[model samples]
Target: MSRRRRKSLPAEPVRCVIERLSHDGRGIAHQNGKTQFVDGALPGETVMAKVVGSRSKFDELRTLEVLEPVAERVTPPCEFADLCGGCSLQHMAGDAQIAFKEKTLREHFAHFGGIEPEHWEPPMRSPDLGYRRKARLGVRFVPKRDSVLVGFREKRNSFLTDIDRCVVMDPRIGDRITDLRAMLYTLQAHDSIAQVEVACGDDAAALVFRNMEPLGSADYERLVAFGKAHDLHIYLQPKGPDTVHRIWPEQGEERLSYRLDDFDLTLKFHPMDFTQVNAGINHKMVALAVEWLDVQPGERVLDLFCGLGNFTLPLARRAGQVVGVEGDDAMVVRGRENARLNDLDNVSFHGANLQGDFTGESWAREGFDKILIDPPRSGAEEVCEYLTAFGARRIVYVSCNPATLARDAGVLVAKGYRLVRAGVMDMFPHTTHVESIALFERK
Candidate 1:
């Protein structure tokens, strides 16, 4: 059987006035009965867009030229923002980006949850740029260019963007992209190096190089020298997660920590462990959660999906007893380690699959006065079903995806909870990723 070829796109740029922004930040316009999703075009602006993709219902186009610009549009902070996939909304102003995210969350709440908060909390924001603390940079030695590239992939394509710096990432790593490329190009195992994973703490940063093959002595020494000169920690992964081991600063523990000054707690984590990418926003989010929970003395609190005790430890400081339950056994161990490091004996961390019924377990038997949940993108539908069983009066939920959060909100509302206040957070700026927090009180 012969495969059908995709229909060709129009070569001439079509003039269209963008009607509005899509959920993912693309501009939507309608020509005749077919819809057009144009990149790099804003609402209320006219642009000439060329079709890059086509479908029976809608067309995909890239802005060829802007005939009229909107006030919300601005020069992107990063030079490569238009090409790199790392940031999608860089052309939009900072305040406008937050407004778009808030609008996105509101729509999600209305569509999926079928309810709205009694009060819309003001958005919790951080620095609009230069705040990313964790990233996995794509590395490749392009044979055609005979050069090594280190940065994010190009928008709508898998090819790595030839960017020298990333303005959105923390300066320690973003500003050194060119330097990283130069160093890797000089190494014998340049082609063998697949990617680099970066994780940063308050005082230090670490880079984990994923090497597809073994590195020679000369290449290894060069890596160490680079680490020493730049005052950065170096790690190498030969095969898998277990093969990741540190090489530089042959001394202290293989751990980096960020301090929560408000709670007087220091949390340590491994380079590969899951940590929040925005440090400042995390600090504010945690504090806000603790305050909203109103953990009175002698009250028992339950923290679900706790990782490294980011919220659990702080809640532990306020409540008499706090139980942190996580799906990952590794994170449970990491949480316990942080508890000991902070000298807090009031908290206990346990490992359990949150997607199933763990209600009969000992952790669930203790009724909680207050609860905090920070689930992943899937949100906490299964857990929300049994939240009433815990006898918690107030619940604070931190969510990375607004759609799932809204979907889970319906389950919670049916279980007799009112969404008192909800708001967006600038956890990831210059991108369409929406992070939100909500407070629930027993209705």
Candidate 2:
């Protein structure tokens, strides 16, 4: 017998004032001795929310009415902002969002790290819409709606949103959302299609479709014709990610690639590989970070969490020697390949789990003059502590989470490093996601 279904809890209407915006862009409010997270609310605003889901400690709600509006709030440009779940903070003005992100970074650093930057670089801003180069789109058939949903998940739900377009995604993907819906609908294996992963480069855009079953010959022909018509490289994943294979009219190139002209670098990535979603700002960020590192010929540099050598190869152009370390061996191998393609022998790779303490002499064995660390959201507390002990003269840290960055900055300051400067990069544009870079010097 099939497993029984779990009934969803009924929603309750409640009125509250949004106190702040969380990192994920959810509005935070407290009511009736409990914390509530509501979507589509701005800080310093009164609103009625319908509690949709609840955990042991907190409840997630949808804003039912805006009783009092905040000055920072603005109408979102995207038609599907509320329903698509692609962006949650779109209603917040761009400037106000940047200010909040900067404030968040400072507060996190002070609270977690017990130190603050002596100087702050202004928040970087860019085009807010159509900025994303990569995204994962869900595929769902809603019988009640009598339509197929080909977009992100619904607000706070696993079910796919019924969307015809997405404004935040790159035009390559957003423009094709409706076409994708139609194409899947025409396929004999429509119910078997699950999702599509999109990745775009300067020259090409690729889409990888996740399917529950193998494609029939007719299904394959339809996909090939579609790829030819759209000039898209289509890959099909019949099972796991490892099973992904191109199923277009032609084999095309084996990999998708992006170019960085500032450092004369070209990085190739698999559809599932981790590359910065915003290519334009990523180049600018690289320039800013390299300028701060001030690499000189014959200087030694260490690049940590170096995925596919995004920063390592660029540093290699200026530094005499650069060592890139990452936890994933596949990334390390790819990084090496990129270095070979660029014909830059100055950079090398090492595989290591960077989140652990580097107390072992072997871990701190490298004699480097400068260090560049771009850690994940967990922050670089362990690595920062190791940096203090290793005594690198200059350290440039790139972070996606301010709270974690602040926490790690405290460790560096305690270890005799001064945060000289920091700034936010609007890599995600309209979204509340914060990407920041900080400089520290051994005092």
Candidate 3:
């Protein structure tokens, strides 16, 4: 061992002006024919960054200082903007962030898919602050800090940041951060509590606490009392997601819910349901998808990955028949219930694994006139292929991942579909998250 000497890593400091932002929010920079991805530097800014890591293609650096600040850069309003890993582009101006996102969307569509939308709907904007309706916050017992750390993850680390408040959360949830911490601290097994997932809508806000063990009697009483005092609903997760149950009030069932005004549907969901994190952007997204689909009376439509009938009920209003398909049976039951609640007979829900074959005889002859897909970040590549022969004249693809959207779009284009229009919606405002809708027509 003494005969072999280990080589130390190279120390290289690169100073460069950020030219643009990548999809993941890293500032792209180039200098002396080498490309560098600098963290914490915004576009159109000069900064000195110390090289922390590098790959064959790109170099990674942490910004030391902004030698020259861009006009679009501003002091982030949230005390946790840089510290909280939940959002990255908060320091960039709202308008500039939207512009960058739009440009990025367009580039993805054209460059990756080799397809161009003939028209573009202006990017939908939401209240730049206090808009997040869903979040999973991390909880840690930091003995050195003499307080429980309750917040999101720190930048580039799994350790939870000791955040007192989050400005981007809905006012109701944002204001309760300190109270939640206090209450959690009172629990008998405070060290066993991991994090709390917060979901809010018009009428109710629910906090689902994920714990490693069941709560003791004292802990249960403290949580229930806190919930009653704040008019909040509390759910406890002792094990897996199926184990999540309401611990507050000791009795009665209240389903967590969110309303989609554009859809005219009030969806009842479990505390653990997968709903959009941004309520404002979700409403706008439904409206945009409906508008792009151009639903007409007597037209049959298919809504894929339809969670709780977000777009299905809205489509039912304008189309003769709307079929909502989801992988979760529980969600399908809720979706059907929502349709019945709205008294919409034209909407039908089916539970099927969307990633699998969806073009069997029973699924093949649906005769849909239009289709709407809001798949997860995985994108609906296989589902897009299955829809090519479904006789849908128009298809509206709503995507949360631009790269996967671009890949699926390429598949659609090759199958005689033309991208008619595409646009972005600023859903997760402070974060680098991109939500976009694209319209494709059979050629």
What is the TM-score of each predicted model, taking all chains together? Answer: 0.98, 0.91, 0.93
Q: Mark the regions of model 3 whose C-alpha exceeds 4 Å error after superposition.
A: 1-14, 30-35, 50-59, 249-252, 361-364
RMSD of each: 1.0, 3.1, 2.5
Residue-by-residue lDDT tens digits, candidate 1, 1-443: 99998787788999989999998888999997999998888999999999888889999888878899999999988888877999889989989999999999999999974689999989889897779999999999988899999999888889899999888888888889889999999999999999999999998899999999999999999999988988889999999998999999789989989999999999999999999999999999999999989999899999999998999999998999999999999899999999999999999999998998888888778789999999999899999998999889999999999999999988999999999989999999999999999999998
Please tell me which predicted candidate would have the highest TM-score against the true structure: 1
Q: Write the per-residue lDDT of candidate 2 for residues 1-443, one digit (tens) a residue.
A: 99987657655678879998887778999977789888999889999888788777888888878899989888888877876667777888988888878887877776873676889898777788888998888887766766677988877678777778888888877888888888888788887788899988888788898989888998888888888888888999988878988876365555788888988899888777788999888988998889999999998888999999999999999999999989999899889989998999988898888878654635347578899999998988878767765567899999998888887887888888889999999988766778999999989
Model 3, 1-443: lDDT tens per residue? Answer: 46765444347666788998877888999866778888789888899888776666777787778999989888989877766788898788899888888888878877874667889889998898889888899888867765788888877778787777888998888888898888888778888899899988688888888989877888888888999999888889999888888877567665777777655678777767888888888888888788888999999899999989888898999998888889989889889888888899988999888887777746447678999999999998888777877888999998998888988999998999998888889988978888888999999
Worst 10 residues of 2 by lDDT: 357-366
Give the alpha-carbon lDDT of every model. 0.93, 0.84, 0.84
- Model 3, residue 103: distance off in Å is 1.7
Candidate no. 2 TM-score: 0.91
RMSD in Å for candidate 3, one decimal?
2.5
Q: Can you list the residue pairs that collide in candidate 3?
A: none
Q: Which lDDT value does model 1 have at 252?
A: 93
